[model samples]
Target: MLQGNTKILLLSLLVFLLIHPSAYSQENSGTIEGTVQNSSGESLPGVHISIPDLELGTVTNANGQFRLTIASPGTYLLRISMVGFEEKTDSISVASGQTITLDIELSPLVFQSDELVVTASRRSQLIGKVSVSMNTISPEELTSRNITSLDQALEYVPGVQVHGNSVNIRGSSGFSYGVGSRVLLLVDGVPLMGPDDGGMDFDGLPLIQTRQIEILKSPGSALYGGGALGGVVNIITKDFSDEPENTVRLYGGGYEPVRFETWRAGWGGGSDFRPRGGIIFGRSHQVTDSFGYWFSGKIHNNSGYLQNSTRKGFETYAKFGWDISEVMNLSMYTGLRRNNNEQFLYWDGLDDVLSPGSINLTGNEASGANDGLSDRLTILPVFQHSINPNIQYTLKGRLFGVAFRPLKDNGHISPPKRHNKGLRYGLEAESTIQATDEMIISGGLSFDENVINSDVFVGEDSLTVRNQPEGALFLQSEYTWNDQLTTTAGVRYDAYQVHTRSTATQFSPKFSASYSINESLTARASFGRGFRVPSVAERFVNNNDFFPLESNITLKPETSTGYEAGVTYISPILDAFSLKAELTSFWNEYRRLVEPTFVNELAAFQFVNVTRARIRGAEASFSVSTLDQNHQIKLGYTYLNTTDRELNQPLLYRSKHLLNGSANSVITDWMEAGIDFRAASPPERVDTDFSLFVPDAEVFPTQYITDIRFKFQVPHVYEGLDVNASFLINNLFDYYYVERPAIFAPPRNFQIVIEALF
Candidate 1:
């Protein structure tokens, strides 16, 4: 054994000598020092501090002090982890013989359960610092929603509007062909958009794959760049952690309105000095009604339920991390998804209303469902490093491609191949600087390029065009004015060059001021300006002749000004129960709006810049939690109301009010259960053509839905191995209501999920 070891060592030395000048040609390195503290100024010891994906790590001493040594003069990622405190990461720059000091403030982990996030600026900064309203859906929350697509998970969030796979924020609606474009979706800071039109297929994103979903409810243009005119949706995936034994999850359920089954599996392992990688594969079988409010065009409780439409999908994602050294790290992630869907249409009514005798519709005849298929592939490569502590930087790039094909027979027995294909590429770089104990600065630049192709030509001459670019620059600064006050401000400049003719530029500014009234109460106010450009669908529909955004050089970008003020009060005196509540009111004015118009003479619709609208609303969330460590009970609620000044009515497809509540408790030493309920007011549809005098439809109201879940440890199983099962019943009481003009909600049905982990 000794002889063999000596031979191996000799070979390793020979290889090293072949690659370098000498083994002892030494190089100098530097170290970093830091301390951790909570809001109360108490030192937090045992905190894990290290450069992510690096071979170096250390723990905080009893006084919350840490030291790290590295051999590089570049940026590195510094991550601080603790059991009861939130995880914080920053980029740091290291110089030879230089010692950097960084003192960190971390919120308690309790907030993680509440789904709070701070990635809007490529760094760790809470939404409270921004003027916009934001909401976060934690992993726990995602599990509660129990749906596979982002479209279903965001339905309960306030100010977030969803119709099927389409999403819009605030009162910005009706931008793309019956869809909305006021929102941008991202995953791990990578833009999740198709290359051609800057929009995404919501269903193509898997909800179960994400560790967190941050929903910013205000125009994020000032930070997220263009297309953020409505808002931003950031999906953060799971981080690199200690290798797990294994994990498997399965779910199956079906009803007259909807049916679905899903399965997922993952594995991970590697040496201590080198980081590991993992891959996950998920497949699901889904089916819905022929026509309904969501999933399909057929109503749930009517004749369409018996003739359910079908949808099946597949998703696969992978992640790999490498530990180059203590000061540098690299990671790669990718995901692929495909969906096949069918939407059944009823032709009997249409045939009678139009060409009465054109076709025979009497005896249970069917025209078949429209066949639609969508596919997406996303690839991201990320590199980060922390030189020392005070400064760090990151480089991330993403390439996304999507294809959508719509096929229909129209009873003509022959249908041409019609589809849309798009591809998008994006890159970003961010730098964080801690100049002083009281100030921190962050800056970043983002660029996106899209290429789109549609079967039908657009414009006056019916021509096809491809390739467009959008870019932005953003910077944010946070300053602490003693212990009583803190202030944050940011600005972003976005530029969009149309395929032809003209370009639009916007400069958005945001500011927020907060005053700490003791340790348990705080007051804050924020203001900002926002703007958005038209979507590709609105600019050039498949079968319509519409001018590109550039041709209409005179068209103004949609703009808004907003203001909000709120106060948070927390108390822990009531029977060890904590009570926290916040109330905020906002008013915004929008201008140079775009709306779809009917070109009756041409037999198709066209997008035109026409009217302006003003919207105002208030929102509040209050929660009372009984702090029992192992068992807890909580109640929460939210309310909102928005109006469109031009139409003298409420905004379309938006709920006027919302309320949510839940309770959680430990059933045993290794078992737990939770129940949740939700309620929302009605929504309204906007009229697209005033000349026709067509009145908008009022969506029917809905009652609350209650859901339950349970988790238990399996006896005689591996440590930490447990099973989780949940039963969700939508329309808990069988409430009959319409979410759209003519579509009805699904009747009461139950869904079940089972998960096992070690």
Candidate 2:
């Protein structure tokens, strides 16, 4: 059995390296560089530096300084975590080649504490730090949760769930075969979906150029490999460290059927190419509408809002950095996007009552015109080797490429233009090993190449090619059975080779446990096993008659098994007001779940896997912050529950009782204001009934909605110029609902924004 499970995982990693030890030592180590400001001094990249009883850690770069290496001199104990700050400890005295310089000041853990604890495993001890089912969205809870995408900002992240815009972790079903390719989207750390449909179109993601939005639900396929089963939504972005800044944003809203507008502008700059590198660039744009149903049939309104149609897009991102000195560093990134579209399709009886609000006379001509373009290139070369300080090593590499243009139909039959191209190429080799002191190990390997030339699934001059070679091997062990229990187990083995099928192997098992119940609070539990394999439009496109791949060849490769229990709380006692909450509940059971079938029937759609379902959900989140010196206030809430175990029903367009709230105030010293609110639960429809020429085929309907926003900011003038403004209101009462009843969800709109910083 693989040598007794690799000798019981090397005798449980030699009993956790003979009881944890290795915080730093090479004669007292010698490196402790500084820089980490925020009491209004800027600079704060990555942030996590620790030495909690010698767990040894480092992460600051991007100008916030940080050069860890301890255990050489004498008296030592340092810790500084970040995630809305507040957790700093210092007491150092070392010598040998001495070089300790400090300048730390962090505060704002939501005005002292209601608990928003999130240092994502780099430690702050929130019950064994991190083992899975994660959620850490803080940029002041993402600008008071005005969220535009990251799947609507993770809809209040808990176990996380969002359907219409896609995002379903813990309760997998990620929208099924086509529109949702089972989770996996990262921004910093690359991979942003669309590599031949691992799915991700968060309305063309650009959430105001992000700054933080980590959500790891679970199953990262061992440090991200293959769509990551159904979790991982990284996103980070937003680094230009002082010296220059500019921003402009506009918004428009509607909800009485639908209507919209949007715009964005950006600018960036960098300096001191040494504090660990820096450089950035950005761009943005948007447009929208939904008067589908011809203004609701001359205003008698059917709410289909004239069948709604129209959408536009644009985006650009760039980054460059290099600092080969402090233990080696390098970075490069690029992204570009484009979109133009018009869509609408509806049918029924006579359709038009003389253009009673017309989608151009009800019925037949259902429109379609699309132009989507994407280009991404990335190069990441990282090397960190502090081999002398309690053993340290990190070598990373990544090369990426992507090009996709999915334009379906246009050319009425013969002479049509035809275009459908998709491509992907990737390479990765990662390593992180800390050997002793209770062990620290990380591993990786990846290679991918995928290509597709759709004709809407191959047909008009068809062209198809698929070559995939996938691999994964992972091992993790973190054990500290004393001071309050901590246990982590790992296992991973995934393999794939498909040119049509053949090589397939999966072995996933991960377990976690964290317990403290003291220093504020902590308790956690986790179990994992996730797998997926079925893409390329779900195994070779063959519609309009051209079936032979064994007609979807008895496909099978979609598994899930997840369980999570959570609890973590930190407090400094009311009055300073601080609270962080997390309540997770998940039960996933799926085996081969891909739907949409109808082969030879002219209006084709097929991607077997038949049926098998089970998705249970529970999510909860809360936040509260209040700081008096600068007058700050924050509030938040989120709750969700999903169920659909083969018709046990309740999982269509998601949205099941979601409420979000927010408020921010800084009053003077340049002014600041904010407010936000949200509500949802109405969207669940996807019935096909039996189509041959369209028999019952249903679409979507079920409605409830609300939205509101207001913001303003202005700080400093000459020296570090700053200015901002925003006002938005969408659906906020113009609500007639129906975002997918054959499409139509926009009504009651308004928006405005302006910004600048230097």
Candidate 3:
């Protein structure tokens, strides 16, 4: 009873369906049968297995097994892909009418990859030969840990710590109240900090698309310029997935009741549950043979563990790729984030730690100054062209903007509203050329401008403006002396001019060498000069009298001379186990160190260049993995010796000893588990007079924290769909701790995560 057009449509649909699946049954066809599993030894279900050249694919079944047939196959490419794990591809030779078997193991993203690192040198180089102490966090690890912000994950990195939103590497920073971060943070090679805060924003980054985080523990100003005095953290975004598909992730969690009734918030039960959850919806596909796009949107809500600490956020991220021609390509990445947060400055006296502390409110202000709305947008476009095999260059353009407006949640009285509207834009071009077989040259030129209009600035009455323009030229040369020895030398010159001020300039230089002593060992050493320009905030911030913070525009830049030596060894200790270990020692001498100082005359705090300081440290870390890479154990230790030359005392807020460890195992085909531990000795000193302003302000104690997590996976939950459920317990011992004076660290908490990939 169907019409002629309907019959035609049905026939076309039937033909299209038969073409992919039935063609493999014909003569001379080849068959591919395979098993897919994670490096942790759990078989993966719902994995997409495909031969892109032939436009044929199959999904793995309940047992992580798959089979596919190809007609008229000679040689083809085989690819397997899944979410939360790395994709794998292989080349296969097909003999007519023959069945080929494959066993594919995909590694999880949490394990660091040392094959290539760009942060250390501003160019791709092998981690082993980079001549720096470099660490990496794989994307899978972030996903597995269910971290909602960037700072939360930094806590697990060796020799690195977070003081509020500021990051300290190798004891290079202290509690300066979110100004002038020594460690530079970048997202896909673009600076991530704003002009007003000069501090990292934890919640605005797009994590779902991050591929890897590279931590270069050395003076990076020679290559990255200012803000790299301590080191660099680069978050590399990912390329589109190999297969076109959609993914969904859902996670939720909350804290357990406080162990002590005295510390309970006036909420549900003894303590508020502080519920939190988030959802991510993502899709990626190829629009044509030469163009593709990937994007995701995330919405997260959190009740927070303390009063006036709630936060809600929404973010969207997208990436597009275009293979314009055989000799050129383009990549475009964009991100937008909107966030509302109730900031908790410090806890009330230890007796009522779950309550927000007052900020010396004046007038009839009712202590509700902790609310704010923030928005951020970033766009980066990169173009590359290949002149020849030895000559290729890239051009990058970027725009980063931030807007923040303070809000009052309850009754309040203030002189003026506070707002920050900032923008940063830049253009850079770089090239890599092989001068000869043993020599390579890399160099770049950059021009950037920063502008901020805000009422929170020291000299600003209402919405005043400040801006700085900068230009830089950098060059690096790498020479391979022989099969076992290599050296790199680089230098950068920078010029900066405030719109209304005179120009200032600096030159940074660096030299490093790496020697492969043997197949299993490598030795490296580096020396560099680093510098940091004072941020607009450090030079002009005015916290509106709630806090005792003032600004001094005369603050000088901070500079350092750093030296490092390290050795890496890969031991063939056992036939069934692989061991990799590293030991490093470093020394840094800083001059004109910028720190916050209490001005007795003004009765406020100010950023001042007050001291010459030194930080010397030793770090050791090792990892052991089974032959099958199924189970892993990692351990690390760091020792720091620091002194303020002007005061003859240890640097404030610098932990002398730190230790961290982790163990992971696959218990069964459908189950896996991991445990992580971190410990630190209490800082030698904090604010000498903090107790006068806030009770127990110097209560930081030697601390220990542990986390445990387990995952259960269901493969083939439906056709081409896989599901994984995870549970996590943080602060397993329920220990009370603080990273900074008077700031309450998170208590014991639990989380559940569900992820589906199709």
Candidate 4:
């Protein structure tokens, strides 16, 4: 049933037959100019000057200049990245009216090898040609910690562990409350979930108009097929700054008021310490010579330190670009978010931690819990054509929708519920083929469709409309077998259907390798296969919140296989320091894993496909920097060893030691300072049958969290303005932890951010 104007006339005839009527004629073009600096010679503004074989690039302003204007004219290779420098490449030559000038320097890199990713091959490359274990997140780590949730900027990355949007990478996810999601979320590479709890709405993204966020831990269903069975993040946005611009940001904060008055009198009181704020607005322009646009919007409110945990929201993002010739290029993206929240779910025990109850499933205890509002929207359209420049062709389309409304106590307007909607639409067609500069190839073909109108997925066929459909086919390749080897391989084929059931298929395969033997050593390896299916609220939920869920329309589909190996080393030591080190080892294996049991003759709870697991791990990271590169320090560690090969032991909420640390310094020329640390090591097992529905399922010890920040860069605050200010502290020294098991994880907080740029 394809209506809606026949799916907008089949996506406008597939972007007008993938636009290409031959167009490429920039007369005799040629030009290049630069001024990047940084080996003690300062300058360096936003660096990144490129020419990855004519893909062109730019960035370097605010006095560090840069310009490129080449439409054609031979010989290239002109890199030069930034993010702590050291990545230069040069080898130029142009003819036909030239205009070259240069002066690039760089040097002060400590293992940041010129990132240019695309979520590990949905295109772009270089991040040392990725072979597993990737992470990137940087947009000043969410505006210097004034972070408005992207899971609090992934709770400080290293081997991730976030508790509310449930992520666990490397330990490979544990909580399965939001239905089915083994990490897979992308925007700017399409794929978005939660069309009825396939989870990952992480506040429905737009994280400060993000510009980079890659993640990609491992096992990505080959070229991304099912819910990526644990891996993939990819949210890359932010663009359109070729001149005209405007931006403004404002922030505020609170929380830091519980000095143990018996935990503020056990929070029997509602709403204490209410504060938190936000504001943002932006714009970018350019309207001719091939269009351009960019936009951002934000509005947040929090009032949450407990009691029904308040929250408010509004998010927005927009992007547009066009240049239909020179071999096409078109992009469009838009997102919107709306939220109202106020419904703390897991408390009321642990000595009434900010009160809100739930511990049902006959273990008894329940209390008012309902306050919500959500509305989300997204649209994406992309096009690229270039059947030149070593082959390229992409055509994507998407339209996502969401709705939720629950509110029935206080501030009333309506109640007794029924307004949950979700819809997903899609299309994809990708291809990249540099098919022979030592093999490049990539492939894609996708389709998706989902619809839901939930009652938490009423099942027993009391269904209130639900549909799911999916399709995929992927291919990948990357070969470089030289200059110290490189390799990659892939495959994917998926199929789905969930309403008139009976059609589920899977196949994903992968292999990877990277070797570099010298040049500061490198070695990597990977193997993968992944799958997941089951999520219409885990196969038709029949909700009761706190527990009493039941629906398992033949549930079954979860598979995984992953393995990794790594080694890295970078050096520079005594010439005034810069070093990097990495070591990794991972192993994963899961099969039919889906929990939420207790089906005593259907007396309740059910989303079965019970356990079979394995999760061996080892991770490490280290870094140091200095050499005109301000200062830096990093540390990472992870060690897990889960096993539940049919209840053998360990693997319930899995987390066996994880740590992360950081330090930054650049205390002058407009200030900077930082510190962060995180630790975890709890939940070795919490399944007393899922704690009979979690009422102080208590298993919280060994977790220390701290964070700190400060920054200022208020220079010439007006003309073409730029201003910045920051100060942050998060749970710093207020670690009364609980990352899982009764929910209490936030106590110390502070913030202040002000930014302006024009």
Candidate 5:
């Protein structure tokens, strides 16, 4: 009953299936099976096994088992790899119409120089092959150290400094309240910074769902867009597993009392002793053969050391994935968070070190109210399709919303009583083509729109809102001349419309080259251009203070160029020991740097592009580990020189020298201990022109701090249950120092954590 054309098509399809080499080979393919285990004879999931020549690979499931089908029977080399484990290679013979089974046992990796990273080039590649400087922190490392916040985790990275909520990388940024940020923060490749102020909210990130954190210590605007003028921090969340997994953690800690009793005077007569604690839960499950889901939640509370600084927050996250077919896939993520806290603008005077009071706090209102509350939600969806063996495309989109309320501000006479809300949506499409075995090209187009409504920022009588739109196009390529030489180049063009009126455009370009001197050594050099668009707050803020700040409609964007060269040596294991070292030097030049300038005649301040600056720095790090990976040591040092070229003076709030070190050892099968230490040569200058009540303070002095931690693990007492406990002592020596002008670092503190896994 079929038509003549339909019959002919069916016949041709039958003939193609019967005679095609691919179809015939698949019908007669052989099967390969394998299991992966660690040195302790425990199943290790997520191990990747591949036959490189055939361009085929598979990851082990929850049971550490994998199965592969080969199109033909022949001899091949099998390569197996996993992070924190030594790689393995083996020669095997495959017979037609036969099944081959093999088992592999891998040892712990002493030095993780070969770990794979994706943020460097937006593609998976060995860390050792990346041309830029970077650092990674794993979930295991976080657990061992009992780190609960992004800032705490980043402190361990070399050439990074955390001051309150701001991060400075290699002296690239000084303090700027909350207006602008040089370092960009990302969660699973999506920007997480607040669009209103271009500031990062470390607490908004779902730390409970993170598997790893990657820090790129170089400008990445060529690939990441704005707010990456200095560097980028990418937090990669965990993926779903084939089997069910659950984890729960609870931690409690307390801060030491103020050092000088006089500093706490005028505050409440009650004890200043404060307590903090948090609870985290995470779970993952495979719904079916091709579907998976992950969920995590966290609740935290802190009775801050300073008066009227208490805070409480909670966050929840979920992700779902579906493998629609062999060539297409889809994934979606959603998260919600809410936080409430008392605001502590600054100290009332030079002597009130531990007290919390703003400039407007009068003697009669010592215990007045100053509070802030925030709620946020985000949703992201992604789809991927493979058109052929060498071509693929991806589409991703995000929707984010934030509501912030300044409940009370005792500092201001008639505290605005403003409720600010912001909404943002973005979409991007990308394509990748493997032109040849040695060449790869990728291109992407992105569009974003943001809208904000506030009674304070915009005029109260004006019903119109502020909107900003952006668009970008980018292209990147990688080429390899041989096994020892490789090069990468990328460029991005971005256009932005501010206040639905003025338009601005920028072009960013990046270039890098790497050459392998030997199997264990590599040298690399890179150059890049970066820029940052002005934030909404910077252009339109009405605080109505003594030195009121006025909006600047003609403010220009901040731009910079940077260059870096580095050499890395990854030593091969020798007699159960290995060593890795890296040395890097970098220089950056900035033009049209945005900063607040005071117009003395007008008795007002305005944000303007009025300065040129330069920063040069060098960093060195060394890591050594034992064969069993039970003992390890790391050391790092950084030296920086910064100058305001136009002002002929040193930059403010930037340290000239820094040193950090850590050592860890497995004391027994169930116990581990570690020690961490850091020393910083204080800032060479301080900003005194701002009318923020900051005193005429001099340079900070050199200071050293140390911390010690011990962890104990208990094997499964019941089926599918394990427990771990940790004790940490921070600032072991109880050294007191000031990180910012009047902001003193906390004295010695202690924390305890308990974790259960199933």
Candidate 6:
């Protein structure tokens, strides 16, 4: 009925309407929804879900729920990842205007090589690619072993020795009465060593809040500065989790009597049974989409095994995080700890197990009460910003305070009550730049100020306060070639000013390389420089006793050069089992090594830089794990040869040969068992003249120790509650050995622990 022009117009309108409808439908996006959970059906938060090809990603919320919007209908590979868990990928298809729902379950990571550690280079990287020897202990491992202290957990590491409260790595440190520690101790990347002695109080750390512990077994002064002449131990605390957790642990144990007939003769026995108990409550929740908080508190009491050795302590921690924006975040952390303990001095003689030694020659076991109190507080705030995908920056500040008061029996003669207080404040700024796909650069600047107040060190009856300020700048770069070879180089410059002493500066440089020879083999090499400045106590301590100690302010800083080479091999799976092995050789040369030299003529001890030393060692380790990860075995051995070049004698307090072995098995769904064993050869030589009470012996005897643990998870006791009971037997063989002369090790002991989680 229309004309020719009208008819053409109508036909064009019809075609346009049909095509527009189809195009509009195609442009509509679809959504993918999913929930991430662990193998045990527990919801897992903070899981990353991504489609790599499409460059689209989202993170699961507290409830493990995630949703992604697709630009168009297509098929893509969906990937999910999280630490301590296996990665999962699946093919997902989406249609226009439709929603796809998925549920994923991830398993726990089994191999140590899969772990990502940060202490190696101050940045997160795969363990397999790290050029230095390192070790990691996870929360699961700590819980399974029923470990209650940080130092107790480190004893299993190869080339490490825990004598009393001191930590020795590769024989880098001898017994110095806690004056200096070559190894550095850090909590959440913040140094906690005492300002006076440069030693740390391992008992003050909140082990209940720890998530993991990483040990870098190589010189780290190029990045960490002083107190890292030997190595570094970094304790990483737990972050805020979406779910709340509460735990209570109760344990009771006892000690065995002295084994030797001579030692048993003087056993001034008390109640042999000791009891320990603690409770921890932690909770974290999302206040808003951009805000979250976590808090925990723990209290513990221990009726120690030895006479007059009792301890009680409590710790509290809190953390808060705010997401300022998509590219910025701010966080704050606070921690406090307080403890009181009765100290036990060394044995009076080898024949007496209960006769404690006295600092004064004319004093008896009960002449004075040796007791002390320790308190610590820490505060930290951090800000992080991402300028771009490849550039990031962080700013952090920390404040730490420690107060210690010791009451000795001979206060009248040597100042009975001495108070020591240390205050430390520091600020750090760091930046990381990913210049390219194969290269990265990082740098940091730090400033630290230490203030110490003490009466015993500066003078008796006079309170003195001193300050030491330090600054450092460090830079490091890592480059990868063809994804098979990687090299890292770093350097640090540090300057420090003592209150009334001289100013000093040090330059440390380190270089390391790793090469992947094959799919299962990797080789690594490293060379580094390390140095340590004298502690305030080392240069000012003045104690008047039978074994007097006089500080020397003319002491120089100690320095060392270290080199190491290692190879690792991961064998292919055979019959649902696999084996991993590593071998490393290391050499270290120290100049101006510090030690307390006894002046026999004056009957005094002086801290001096008097020795040039060389230490060479080799370590071998092997681990076996089943494909199902239900059974595992680990073995490690270390051989060390140390020489004091100036004295032409072997270094003191170091074992020439060491062996460690452990096995863990999940025998049933709810039952797990583990065994740990250690053996060490005696020191080749010791300085028996340092103590008259100790027997004069050129060589100490070898020692063997073993521990066994079993844990049973109770089922269906209560809804939404988990309960576990553990049994531990330490020093299983009842072997009697001395860690230090006249200081016998703890005999066989038993502990029963009952823990509940909700």
User: Is 2 or 4 the stronger prediction by lDDT?
Assistant: 4
* CA lDDT of every candidate: 0.58, 0.52, 0.79, 0.77, 0.78, 0.76
Please give, for residues 58-132, the per-residue lDDT of candidate 4 as tens digits. 555423556677778778888876433557788899776687999877765554455566787666555654678
Q: Please report how far candidate 1 places residue 622 from its true position, in Å.
A: 1.4
Q: How close is candidate 1 to the true structure, as a TM-score?
A: 0.74
Q: Could you tell me the TM-score of candidate 3?
A: 0.83
**What's the CA error at residue 330 for candidate 1, in Å?**
1.8
| CA-only RMSD, every prediction | 14.1, 23.2, 13.6, 23.6, 6.6, 10.4
Tens digits of per-residue lDDT for model 5 on 14-53? Answer: 7664323234456567878867887745565446778999
Alpha carbon deviation, residue 728, candidate 2 (Å): 2.9
User: Which of 1 and 5 is ahead in lDDT?
Assistant: 5
Best of the candidates, TM-score: 5
Distance from true location, Cα of 233 in model 1, Å? 1.6
Give the per-residue lDDT of model 6 (tens digit) for 1-758.
Answer: 46988999988877554323223333578888877777755565446788999987765543455667788679999999754467899998998888889888877655434555678887766678789999888888777776777788888898888876668888888566535788898877777677778886675445456778998888889978998898999988776666665666676666766555665556445324456666655566657778888776667787665566778888888888999998799998888988877766566655564555554422422221256777888888989887754567889898889888774544222242467888989999989765443456889999998898876477332447778899999999887664468899999999987546588899999999999787678899999999889888787777653246665778888888999999998764755777789999999999887777777664566788888999999999999999777899999999999999998998878899999999999999999999999999998877655554333323357989999999999976898788899999999998878776556667788888888777
Give the alpha carbon lDDT tens digit for every residue of 1-758 in model 2: 99999999989877665333322246545777787877755665446777877677765543455666665466678888764467888888767778778888777554333222222232122312564566667655554444544566675554455654457665465344243366777666555566455577564444546666677776665555556676777666554442234444433333232222110011011110101111122332211121100000000011122322334445455555455555554545554545443334322212220011212211332222223434444444445554333334444454445554544446132222234456665655545444432344545555666666555454222545455566677665655544455676767787876445377778887777777666556778888777777766566555332222112534567776777787766564455765556666666666666665555553344567655666665666666555453443333333445555666766544555555555566666445555545555554435442222332224443444455555666666566666666666655676544333233344555545444544
CA displacement after TM-score superposition, residue 367 of candidate 4 (Å):
36
Backbone atom clashes (below 3 Å) for every candidate: 26, 38, 0, 1, 0, 2
Clashing pairs in 4: 201-204
For residues 610-647, could you state the per-residue lDDT of candidate 1 as single tens digits? 65676667767766665654555544444545565776
Tens-digit lDDT string for candidate 3 (538-606): 878766434676767777778989999999987545577778899999999998987777677866667
Which has the greatest lDDT?
3
Q: Model 6, poorest ten-residue lDDT window? A: 360-369
Clashing pairs in 5: none
The TM-scores, one per candidate, come to 0.74, 0.31, 0.83, 0.31, 0.85, 0.84
